[model samples]
Target: MFQGWNALLASVWGCCLIGFTWGQLSDSPDVLRNWCLDSDYHKPQPGPEPQLFSECSPWKERSCCNATVSKLIHHNVKVWHGFQFRHCPPQVSSECLRFFRRDFCFYECSPNLGPWVEFEYARKSRQQRFRNVPLCASECEAWFHACKDDLTCVRNWGSEFDWIEGTNRCPENAKCQLIRDTYADAKDFCETVWDNDFKYTPDNEPCMVLSFDPSSGNPNDNVTEAAISRHMNSINSMLNRQRIMERSFSCRISPSIAVSRGIPKLVCDFSFREFDKMRQLKGKPKETPRQKKERKQDFSPENQHKALRVALPIFVGFWVLIGIFIYLNTRPKH
Candidate 1:
């Protein structure tokens, strides 16, 4: 009777174990089947064998088995994370916050930031200056005269007259002369008389004159009215100051003017012989007569024909040999 009781207890335990495994497999049949077929599942099959947990299951034994669980949890957490919740830390100190907030930080937080602040400031400053005092043609003329009084004014002064007229007014130290002509003539005159260090003034016509030198003492001795008039007529002929605020306004605003004029053209007289000598020393090498003749000979039709004749037979024989070998091998291998 004790043996019978022992058998019954054993059978009951075995039944319970089998029922538990069946329930587990039913709960996750796909995972279980994949686990069974998995290369790492090394238990012997087709016999009475113990069931094992899948790597994807909570009961898995190896740490590597936990990878799927970790991945799932990470994906769930990431889905809930929001971008707006991420805020930048404040960069300015508390002491500087008042001034910085009033003047600087507003720009820092902007999407595009303050890229054009300096340019805007400069434009505003210019606008304010223009509002305070405006420039006029008369003012521009006054500025011109003031420039003449200074020993250093040459091409820097405004040019308002043709070469002849300017010569009459410019200081003697300024080598003012006029040359009547077209642009080409003016260029030639400049090269001839002024050694190319000169400028041109034309109300609407061509004229040329030496550039004034301010550093030299009184130019009147060397300059003559005839020279000025002659050059002016030769080219085409033509002729033709500031303040501050009250006390600050009382200050003499410096005179300023914009002068646009053409500079002189100097003569470039180079000899062909000298140019040729330079080419001989520094230019690229030239092909020799013999090399040129040889190149022509190599490309002649007879040579091409000779080369083709030598190559054709050899190429034909190689292919014929290959074809024969293929036929012999592929013939039914009895």
Candidate 2:
């Protein structure tokens, strides 16, 4: 009888867990779409960080790290992963240090790292990480050139740094060397640091920025949404805890993502056609499957200009049709 009772309780617990997982997946594709990483570090959701440090301010509009974390990141007093930038000769120059700080800013603060987030299978602490995020060639070249003359003891900051006394020190018998000499070239420099966390993309392409002019609108936002939209479409089928394919970063994330799971994604602006379809759905009684699918596929804002172009015509035509119908109905038995 005790065995039977235990079995029943286990079954009930499993079902409840499964229900919770499905609930997260069934949420609005838009809300379910954008998220931060699930770790000791990130916030439950990305929101305004108005008080973020000036160096990390570019992400203030939407950030994973709060003001406290931003402040921590800016201070050299906070030792990260046992790293010491001064582990080599001729100390990291201010220009080169700025580049490193910007890189950390993006990793620690930006909500835009969504597309590349993945689980680390072999990691002992098992923190999820973003992989192969694209960096603009110009930025990569600039980073490389800025630090080329500076010295670092290791080629891969992720794996090779030898931690000691709560900070990194040069490995045994390893000599310090110039950054340019440490890496083969600009592409090699970008890819090899931190074990291929970044890939170089040429200018005018849809690469991300470590820093940007936020006033003009963020180019990376479009890239993130497009990738998320693709992930959403593929997840249409029910995913039980076992089958793993790709992403997410809130409690909104699933059991599968709790393990090593990820997917890279596409980049483009949201589309206006989707905006039109969404508008039409307001107050509708029901929708056909085709309509539902169309709505799902239309991730928002393909282009800001395009949305305005499409929406304005619909607004004008609706008024024009109303005028014509009113005129005909009022005509003398026409």
Candidate 3:
């Protein structure tokens, strides 16, 4: 029993280190790494796992999830976090549902989401989210074709659904319609269904596919690494160009804008090359690259506070872990 507690205490300390490391990562442009969400289901870090189950098997060589979660999400469960597929009368088709399962497997298991990882500001707890992930055009087409005949009432599955008794139900104002009727095209379906989590792309350029044959290769690995490299080169080029003046972005929130829809937007002119790809998504017009120079703010006070919030808990936890370890080992035992 004491030995088990020792391992548990050690794990808590490791989580503390991860918290501090991630806080530092936000301030440092040179460091990016494969990361998993701080979720109850995810492992601390991504690594090789050879025995993942069913549709999730393709990620077995490198995954953020274990076989237990893969099996649970595939077999023993049909709903997660109050979301379910049986919102319409005819219900979702098996093939269509399988496509969704594969997508979930990718989201929960693949560590390649690093380049697009962002924070879920809406959640009180710290959680990582993927933003504007570019999906291979073929997979989007395939998913849409399979599900077109199925029924749904909402465009955005992430936040538009209504839940009752812990399962999703169509909103009171919504009437079920065919998936094709709900979304204009595969691109629209991919982009809006998850509220911009995925950006559909027609280009043959390296993009992520939800499911792949392991015998061939995992394109996700190549795609994210390439994006990171491209992003680094872009950053280095910008710094070299601005070495004398050090240009950076300064965004301001336009809180007084009347007739604003939903959340307020932050307005800014600064831009980066890799971020340009996402501008092409959802019919958003791309802004011309600007060369105006502004002083780069490295670790502002607000960032310092954020770092402190992350670090304070870690510091307390480390001492607490040490205390527990010492108590267990030094205390008299029968």
TM-score of each: 0.15, 0.59, 0.63
Q: Write the per-residue lDDT of candidate 2 for residues 1-334, one digit (tens) a residue.
A: 3334435545664575556444233234454335676666678688888898867788888888898877777786225545678778656788888888888778777777666766666554336677787888989999999999998878988888776776677889888899989999899999888898888888776688898876676667876676566655544433321111112221113333333323222100122233234445776546768888888667556655677899999999999999999998898882
Q: Model 3, range 121-174, lDDT digits (tens) per residue? A: 764333767778889999899999999999999999878887678778888989
| lDDT score of residue 157 within candidate 3 | 88
lDDT of 1 by residue, 283-308 (tens): 76467689999999988899888988
Candidate 1's C-alpha lDDT? 0.28
Among these predictions, the greatest lDDT belongs to 3
Q: Scored by CA lDDT, what does every candidate get?
A: 0.28, 0.69, 0.72
Angstrom error at residue 182, model 2: 0.8
Query: Model 2, stretches more than 4 Å misplaced?
Result: 1-33, 121-126, 229-334
Instruction: Identify the leading candidate in terms of TM-score.
Output: 3
Task: Tell me how many clashing residue pairs each candidate has.
Answer: 20, 7, 0
- When 2 and 3 are scored with lDDT, the better candidate is 3
